[model samples]
Target: MESNLINKDEEVIRRSKTEIVLKLLEYLKPYKLKSFIVILLMIIVMICGIINPLLLEIAIDNYVVNKNVEGLMIIGAALVIINLIAWILSKIRWTMITSVTNNILVNIRHQLYSHIQTLSFDFFDSRPVGKILARVVGDVNALKNLFSQSIQSFIPQLLNLVCVAVIMFILNFKLALACTILLPILGIAMFYIEIHSRRRWEVYRNKRSNLNGFTHEDFSGIKVVQGFAREKETEKNFKAMVKELGDAFIKAVKLNDFFWPLVELSWGAGTLVVFFVGYKLITNNEIKIGTLIAFLMYVGMFWRPIMNLSNFYNTLITNFSAADRIFDILDVKPVIKNSKNAKNIGKIHGTVEFKNVSFSYDDNTEVLKNVSFKVNKGERIALVGPTGAGKSTIISLLSRFYDPTSGEILIDGKNIKYVDLESLRSQMGIMLQDTFLFSTTIMENIRYGRLDASDEEVIAAAKAVNAHDFIMKLEKGYHTEVNERGSRLSLGQRQLVSFARALLANPRILILDEATSNIDTETEKLVQSGIEKLLYSRTSFVVAHRLSTIRDCDKIMVIDNGRIAELGNHDELIRKKGIYYDLYMTQYKFLNE
Candidate 1:
């Protein structure tokens, strides 16, 4: 039963490989003319190669034995010319094929990256950055040799092999048959080698991905690791990952190393058999000395192609595994896609409504229940909830990051699902607890919110967020380079910059998700007026860690267990003495005491 199950799985894998190859061929359609020219050149090159051996036989029989120097020189010169033409054709074929393959690679990589961008957040949430990078970079690179060189090499070798086999039989049937006695044995060895090597190659690729993931994760968390003084433990873990990767590579290489020796064994055995048989035929006067010599050359031609084929087969199996991985990512259709009838909504008035909304990451577990809420145009709404009470989920839903499981969210009476994603997102600005800044000048980071913003406008936005003073204090002012993720800046400084970015966007709807969590008391106080100014005339949802920040908001929603436990202004909620009042008292107990 187990064997049957494994056989079925292997059958499925074989079918998948066939489909992937077919899909990849679609990318080759544009290069058909060039590919056809390459095929023609290979055919001419193979003809040239075959004629060389026949010319040698003629020179020996008609020129050399008769001691005719003139005839020898003529045939020798012809041989050199034929080889030169073949070399030129082969070089041209390589150039043409390489050009086609490079374009195909670019197309494939572009398609993969574009598709990944369309995928929803859940896709990224489930996979690590390194794994995605491995598929995009390493796996795509592995297909380079397969596409550019494999067709030219494999087809020419196969033609040579077949042509030699036919010529040998026509020259001497018995000798040809004798030489091929070990062919079946060679084929069997190659088959089993591919089967085992494929499994090993898969293991090797998986280990490589794991190693990439580990390295990226460790480097990304280097600060935390050093702060906890876990450098020794980190080193030990890294060593273990490297050892596993090394072992997997060695195992795969060991399997591959067996292929060349196997080819050599078959070649040597075939040559010995042909030599013995051809010598007997020559002595018996059944075939001439020239024919015997030609037969020997034909044996080499046959075995050489087989040897080349064995190497090609090794490359094919390894790259096929890589191709399989790349196609796996391509096959994952984005779960979220706009419907055919979806309309591109124009500028929204920002009257947001969630009607009987419910959400779940997975089917079995619910994160938010039938929650409903409304935010009038330009009203400031604050959502106060404990960790995991679905506060962030609400913000994500509002932005249409993830669609509600069973309800509709409308902006100005228009279902957001119908809105063009770009048009919808363009009018909303978001600032999260973790502010991400690229490695660029401070001016560029602020201008990111509005790419077309003038330098003066960027400085104005920065000034509005109280970020311009610190930016100017730097040696280069707005031009000062902030390293990766703005590592050079203090946490409060990063948040201030992020706030400026959002403010500059001038979004009708703004979301501040614990945006001030990292700001010190003094910094928060300094930026409070700037924050109030930015929030003016914007429909805003502030997920506040410091409840005092939302005291003057139009409404304060105290969420508990994904439900609205209390909903009113801060003063109204405090008078009601419910969940809001309790949370407000507990979180502010120190200040009150």
Candidate 2:
């Protein structure tokens, strides 16, 4: 699946740079007034910069040459005032840009997370959790400088460049032409550098994402690693991944580093040409000493913005891949979203029917093949099957996690696909094999089943599931906080808490997919009593390996190879001595031994 996902990523149509820039600019629409203000301040700062060299020329030629101390002092004071104003404006612009950039990032992250939640289970099944997190956290963050710096540096530097060029031309056209003669060569160098650097940065981003995926998977299964004493092996693998990432970074940086030096070289060569030409002009009396000095200052100002622009361009290329990745997720229309005319199904009567349902995660293999089943208002069904035998796929289909590739699923006579997803899911409760709990007080964890449930209701549900005794025995009772995934709790305890949470929801339909596999026989019996009471009048589905637990269910389904091999009540199936009978007899004999 990881390899398939990587292939799909590689095949993604890369958006043009202009498209990305245009999309980024769309984020600024909401802050138009603030952006305008920022731009206005930048222009003011650039104007101040352009005036400084002229003031220097006045002080040098009109005051110093004439020995006019008072005039020189006035020009000196004006330069200070202009620079001080520019500094103040620059600081304000920085603050505004930072705030705007942060808000845009927040909006983007929120949208990405919300869209991910709406995607089909297949989307998650194909990708690692760490890779998704990388897009949400790392990729989104990479765009931070692109937003802030584009405004902070790009705009101001561009305006300063144009203004300085105009001032230099006004002072002396011949020298101005000499100062800019190397720009064409610089542009050509940058063009080649950008072409190479962009590809390297894209490679670097992919390597970083791979590292993130491995790190997340490694830590998630850290206990398993230690249990098998594979810590050293994992450490070796981790170092290899880190080295790969480091190598990719070095390759990218080697190319990116060329931008600055190339700009510097152009600046140095341009300054020398200006000096040579200005000397010739001075000797011919075509330009005054003050004018030549002012022209030199303008030349420095001119190249400074070019260097700044180059840095901004470098930032754009480096992070544009991240921007493309972010947009890729945003561009994916959720495969499991509500239809335009879909409406709420309101409260359902727990009648579920899968008519000739079939599904496949990909194009090649079908997980469920034309399997049909029906559960009346209050019938309890037990599904018994081997691993990967489509038992879980049946439940997932009923929940509408993924729509069938063929046929239709109806709940209370309405097609589930036409109903509002939230309304459809609200009436059903599911508990899976791998139980998970949030890092919070046990009381809060139970209350998550029904957010508005009272403390009394939460406690009652916990008591019903036989979890209250173990919970109360803790140091802080129900208020005790658990670690991530409730790692601090025993497996049986976690399953019990999950069971209680499901019970608290008061769902009309309940699913228990190996919900009691972790509990011992003694606890299972105790929990079974509560389960019997809770199962009264509520339609429930149980998938368990323990035949004893399903012996009394209304019906037992033996699913094999994506098809139902046997379906009957315990006594009825036992009389026929079929698949259910064989399974039950084997487990029954094992338990006796």
Candidate 3:
């Protein structure tokens, strides 16, 4: 059963590859002028190439055999001039092809970039940055080669073969037909080479993507790897990855080793057949010596282009392997799309309700079972729970990061699904557990919350979050560089800056997910005070490990195993002596210590 399923999947993948290739061909539509110019050059070059060897035949029969040196010299000069023209035309054709392919690739990359940005968080969550980068840069270049070199190289060769075949028939029909008879042998060999090489190249491309993803994941978690003393292990893993890549490449080359030999054998066989038959015809005096020599020359010329066309086909297949990987991402339709009727959340009342909501990350188990809650405007709700208690899941639902599998979540009496995602997210400010900062200045990072915000507004927002004093002390003050992920600054300092950014957003709903847990006490105090001021007249959800932060909250809910086990005021719940009470006592003691 598993083997059958695997075969079916392979068939599906092959079919999809064909579809993607057809779709990518459409990107060439806009550059009609360049395509036409390249094609025109190709025809001219092929015609000159076909006529080239005939010039030699003329020199041999009419000039050399007749003992006319002046006639030979004139014919030889004409050949030189035609060859020169062919070279120039070929150069221009290649130039146009390269120019067209590059512009098409640029358009593809731009559209891919814009589409990715429009995608929801789930799209990014499931894909790595390096994998996506490889698609845009690596895969794009692969397609570029397909358009620029493969198309340009193959077309001229194909046209040359057709023209040569026609001329050969006109000269001697029997030998021309006999020479092409070995196509079956070449076809069989090409089939095996193509199939075998494609398999190896598929592995090569996939391994490359995996290696890219590993690099991205490792670099992003370098601190963790170093702190855990896993550098040697990482090195070992990286070596294994590269070795696998090398093996795949070697496999491809080994298969390629036979490709040229097989093609040459076919060409040699055809040449021998043509030679023997033409010799017989000459001996019988059925064809002129000049015509026979010219026919042989044309056949030889035809062989080269035919061989090149096959090789170009091979290159196209391999490059398409890479292009297929890229187009796969481009072809993926985002699961979440905006509704035509969805209205922008210009202003929200902040009245939220989770009504009989249930959700599951997987089919086998439920994460949030029948969660029910409501919070009025200006209310601060604190969620407390042991790890894996669905506390974070609840927040995800509230923020519309994921919709509930069952039931509805409402913001100001409107179903969240019906609201514009961009507008909805903009109205909600989040201080995530892992705050991300770009390799930019402190002022810019803060101003990210409001792009049009001026320097004065940024300063005020930083001060409001008690981040101003520390930021001002830095070497560049507001212009201080916060390296990637704020690696240059201490954890507490980064959190302070993140807090200021959130404050600047001034969201109708604010969330702090252990927003103060990583900061020092001094900074914690500053953050706590900042929270107090920022939450004023705004709906807030605080997810804290330390119960001390929620004492003054309007309400507290203790989640257990994806269900709300208790809900009440902190003091009220403590008196009741239930789960919330027990959790508070244990966590509060740890905080106090």
Candidate 4:
């Protein structure tokens, strides 16, 4: 949607991320031993590289000028030795840098991912997946460049360039100054380009992330799109983003389009000036022709390093941009992390109460309007309502998915907010409308309900839910892989497995959300009995589309537009002939047939 794209705010275009860079450098302090070795190799590589131009001079002036054939052979042998030394040092440097960079990148990725898991649910609630992933993949890659690979390559070549500059100045100051004018001007030009291009590149990265987000969302909900037959519409929307992304990419390239060429052309002009200056100096017998030739060799030798620097100059900034993204995530203070004096969770007794609870997602019209209720241990409470009647919101409140805007939800006698989240959640089991199963074995998926549950316990849970028979029919039986998001199983089978998972949890509070909606009537009867066994000693909240699923509950509360309209047993509610009686008569009259 056009509404979802960035607002084109220049404020979001940040300066080069330097602080996080320093922080990343600080993170690398633990690896000081490896970094010290890397730096040592860099010095050796630079020193060896700087020797080549000097060798070219000796080959020309010391041997050829003397016209001594023996001298020529000696100089030529020494040049070969120099080249061999340089080659060996360069290989060692390359190997060290590559290995260190890969390892450092690996460490950073794991650390960042782990940090993300520690964040509370609200942080994920507000951000788009595309934007978040941009940080994880794009920004982390940038940090890899700035931290490890960039330092090694830039340092060695940079040291080599400086050494060559010193050599040129020593041989001929006038010629060297003429050659060196390009350096300052090129540096100034690069600075301007980097500043301007960073925003463009940041935008480019953001756009790319947006594309990733769209692709992720579209693919994740392909079934919904197919069901609605809106594939063409989705394609059209996707194409629009692709076109915008193309435009943004081209703009990024255009921002520094002249950078490389200008550097090269300026280098060319400087070299030509050097040639002319050297010729004039030679005419006056102020410098040897050999010296001038060697200086020319040095100038050409260092041009690549300088130009490559232009790219890294911009890259260093992009890496910072990545750090900025990562820090943005890290900076998010968790809404529900453990407090300073947070204590471990104790056992739950499952007495839940909502005292005048009212909630609004933000400062607007309220969703839950001072609704209140209570449930004792071992009670089966059915929450029945039309869509958006706040049944799920009430369950979400009970689960602490979102804190109430006003008033309190208490568990037993303790405030639910004060109760440790892990303990509160551990005591509750929730099966959602759309079941979630990971890409692992069926047994493992069920075992996730209670990680320490034995294989025998898992099998028992599956049998209770009537899923073990179907699972055993598979070729791999309990060990059969579910594939990503349970793509390997039918919807009904996934629901059955989810039921088994909840059964294995054996929680003190159970929330069954359409537990048997997709299953056939025969299986629903079996699962309903299994659910009864699971809920026998626990407080249970049942949200069901089929009235039959809730007929056996201890009490049924019919919610209408966020207010409880009626509360009674199935027979009593029918006899009262209220909203429940009308809905039950309309939606479930087939049972009487």
Listed per model in order, the count of residue pairs whose N, CA or C atoms clash below 3 Å is 0, 0, 0, 0
Candidate 1: C-alpha lDDT = 0.86
Position 473, candidate 1: lDDT: 97
lDDT of 1 by residue, 1-593 (tens): 01111001111133255676677778889888888889889889988988888999999989989999999999999999999999999899888988998998999899999988998887787667777787799988888877775667677788878988999899899999988999899889888988889888887777777777777777888999999999999888788878987998899999889889988988898889888988888889998888888888888888888888888778877777778777777777776767677777788788999999999988887888999989999999999988999899999998888999999999989888877788888999999999999999999999999999999999999999899888999999999999999999999999999999999899999999999999999999889988998899999999986888899999888888888888899999999988888888998996778
Candidate 2: misplaced stretches above 4 Å? Answer: 1-13
Give the winner by lDDT. Answer: 2
Clashes of 4: 0
What does the lDDT read for residue 545 in candidate 2?
Answer: 92
| Candidate achieving higher TM-score, 2 or 3 | 2
The TM-score measured for candidate 3 stands at 0.91
Comparing 1 with 2 on TM-score, the higher-scoring candidate is 2
Model 4, residue 140: displacement in angstroms?
3.6
What lDDT score goes with residue 424 in model 4?
Answer: 77
> lDDT order of candidates, best first?
2, 1, 3, 4
> Which scores higher on lDDT, 1 or 3?
1
Tens-place lDDT digits, model 2, residues 1-593: 23324212332346899999999999889988998899999999889988988999989989999999999989989999999999999999989999999999999999899999888777787787888898999999999999888877877788788888888888889999999999999999999988988888787777777778878888999989999999999888788878978998999999899999999999999999999999999999998999999988898899999998999999999998899888888887778989899999988788888899988988999988899888898999999988899999898988888889999999888999999999989989999989999999999999999999999999999999888999999999999998889998988889889888988998998998888898887778778877886788889999999888888899888899888888989899999998888888998899889
- Any residue pairs clashing in model 1, and if so which? none
| Pairs of colliding residues, candidate 3 | none
TM values, all candidates: 0.94, 0.96, 0.91, 0.88
